[model samples]
Target: MGRPRVRFTGRTEADAEAVLAAAAAHDACLSGAPADWEIPAGCAA
Candidate 1:
């Protein structure tokens, strides 16, 4: 299986950041991973 993908659409940068932050927090809580998540170089705007 391949990694899952999430698509966020918005008219501003804040919207995208919010989605990424939320996803990161969700992942950390569910997987017991670190909360500090960095967006990949290629994935960041």
Candidate 2:
């Protein structure tokens, strides 16, 4: 069997962050992601 999946969509950055936080709470491994990615122009929060 394959692992179950969950998806979230948000129109704002804060909404996106909330969804990400919820997912991470359920899976500790998700909280260890790298933080070296760059945000493109006008995409900065």
Best by lDDT: 1
TM-score of each: 0.36, 0.36
In candidate 2 the C-alpha lDDT for residue 5 amounts to 51
lDDT of 1 at 20: 67
Which regions of candidate 1 are displaced past 4 Å? Answer: 1-14, 31-45
lDDT score of model 2? 0.43
Instruction: Give model 1 RMSD, 1 decimal.
Output: 8.9
lDDT of each residue in 1-45, candidate 2, tens digit only = 433454444347756665556455435433333232322222334
C-alpha local distance difference test of each model: 0.50, 0.43
Model 1 local distance difference test score: 0.50
